[model samples]
Target: MRVDVEYLEYLWPMRHYLITCGDFKGTANIIAVSFCMPVSKEPPMVACAIGKSAYSCGLIEQNGEFVVNVPPKELKRQIYYCGFHSGRFVNKFQESGLTAQTARSVKAPIIQECTAFLECQVTQAIDTGDKRLFIGTVLEAYADEDVHKGERIIEYAAGDFPRQVYGGRFA
Candidate 1:
C-alpha cells in the first residue's frame, strides 16, 4: 500500500522529552519535543527540531543553551501540557509541578523529575522552512541511578504503538 507522505508521522515512534531554555538570569521555559536525536559522538552533539514560533525556540536562540530532559511515562500529562500550551503565557514548570534543577554547565535548568539530562550549547542552527534545527554540543550528561539500572523513559507514538514498544523493554 502506498502511504501519503503527509501522514508519515506513523513511520516510527519518537521519544518525547522536555527541553528547557531561557536567558542566563531570567524566566525559563519548557517545551515538549519528539524530534530530537544525538547527531555526533566524539564531541557529543544532539539536534532538536523546534517550530520557529515556539517560545522555547526564542529562548534557546537568545541563550544559546538548553537541557534535554528524559521523562518517564508517568509524566505523560505534563508532557502533553507542555506540548499543547504556550510557555510564553504559562509557567509550565509551575503549572505541571515539575522541579527545575540547575544544570552544571549551562544556564538552562533540567527537570528534576526526568531520568536523565543532556545539557547543551548551540553549535549550529539549520532552517528547514517550517522548523529550525538546533544542533547543540553536549556539555554534560548525567542520569539517575535507576535509569542506569534499566528504568524506562517515555516514548511518544501518538497512541499507535503498544506500550511495550517504548516502556524500556524495547529500549
Candidate 2:
C-alpha cells in the first residue's frame, strides 16, 4: 500500500508537552507541542518546532530561553487550552490554573503542575518551512519521582494519526 509522503507524521506516536517561555518580566506563555525531541544526550540538547506565527516563538526569540514541561494525562484539558488559545491576549498560566515557578538556569518559568521540567537555553534557531526549529541546550532537569515510576507521561497524535496506526501509545 503506497502512502502519501504528507502523511509521514503518522509514522510515530508523538508525546504532548507543555512548552513554557517568556521574557521573565511580564510576558509569560505556555503552549502545547508534540513536535519536540531530544537531539543530544551528552550535552543535553533538545529541539522544538514552533510555527513562525506562534506567540511563543517571538517570546523564545526575545529571551533565547524556554522550559519544556511534561504534563500528565490529567492536564489534558489545560494542554489543549494552551495550544488553541493565543498568548498575545490571554495569560495561559492564570487561565489554565498552572503555577509558574522560576527556573534555575533560564528566565522562562516552569509549570509546577507538570510531571517534569527541562530548563533550556536556545543554542540555535533554524528556519524550517513554516516553522522554526529551536535547538536548546538543557541546563537543568527535574521530575516528579512518583509520576515517573511507570509510564505516566501523556501522549498525543494529531487528527487521524491515532486511528491509522499505533493507537497513540506512550514511550
Candidate 3:
C-alpha cells in the first residue's frame, strides 16, 4: 500500500499558536499555529512557522517583533476562538475576553492569560515551502504567578489536554 501526505492532512490541524504583534503598532495581530520550538540555547533562540496568508505574517516581517504566548488550559475557549477566527473582523482579545499586557523589551503586548510568555525579537526568516520560518531571540521570559514548583506547563496532546494541578513537589 502507498501512503499519500495529502490523504493524512485531514487527520489533524496540529492545534498550537504562533502569536505575532507590532505591524500596525496599537493593533497587533496575533497568529495561532502548531509550529513553535526552541532552536538555540547559547543566545536563547526560538522558531515558529507562519503561513504566508496569515495576517500576522506581514506584521512580523515588517516590524520584526512578537511575543510567543503559551495559553494555559483555562483559556482553552479563548484559544479556540483566536485560533479559528480571523483577526480581520473582530478584536480577538475583546471577543475572547483575554487581557493583554506589555512585555519588557518589545512593543508587542503579551497575552496575559498564558502561563508562560517569551518576548522575542526576530533575527531571521527563512522560506520553508508553504510557511515562513521565523527565528527570534528571546529578550525576556517569565511565568505566571499561578504556576507552582510541581505544576506542569499546559499542553494540548491528542485532543484537549486536561489541566494538572500541582501541590508542592518539584519535578
- What tens digits encode model 2's per-residue C-alpha lDDT throughout 11-121? 555677899999556898998888899999999999999989999999999899989998877787887789889899899998999998888888888888887889999
Query: Tens digits of per-residue lDDT for model 3 on 37-147?
Result: 899998999999887776778878888888888765566666667767777777777788777777788887887667777888999999998689999999998886547
TM-score for each model: 0.85, 0.84, 0.78
Name every residue pair that clashes in candidate 2.
none
True-structure lDDT of candidate 2: 0.82
Question: Model 3 TM-score?
Answer: 0.78
Where model 1 places Cα greater than 4 Å from the true spot, the runs are: 1-7, 151-171
lDDT of 1 by residue, 7-93 (tens): 334545667888999843567889988789999998999999899999988888888989998888788888888988898899888
Model 3 bad stretches (over 4 Å)? 5-15, 23-25, 145-148, 151-171
Backbone clashes in model 3, listed as residue pairs:
16-33, 17-33, 18-33
Please list the residue runs of candidate 2 whose C-alpha ends up more than 4 Å from where it truly belongs after superposition: 1-5, 148-171
Q: Of the pair 1 and 3, which is ahead by TM-score?
A: 1
The residue-level lDDT of candidate 3 at 67 comes to 87
**CA lDDT, candidate 2, residue 114:** 81
Cα deviation at 82, candidate 3, in Å, is 1.3
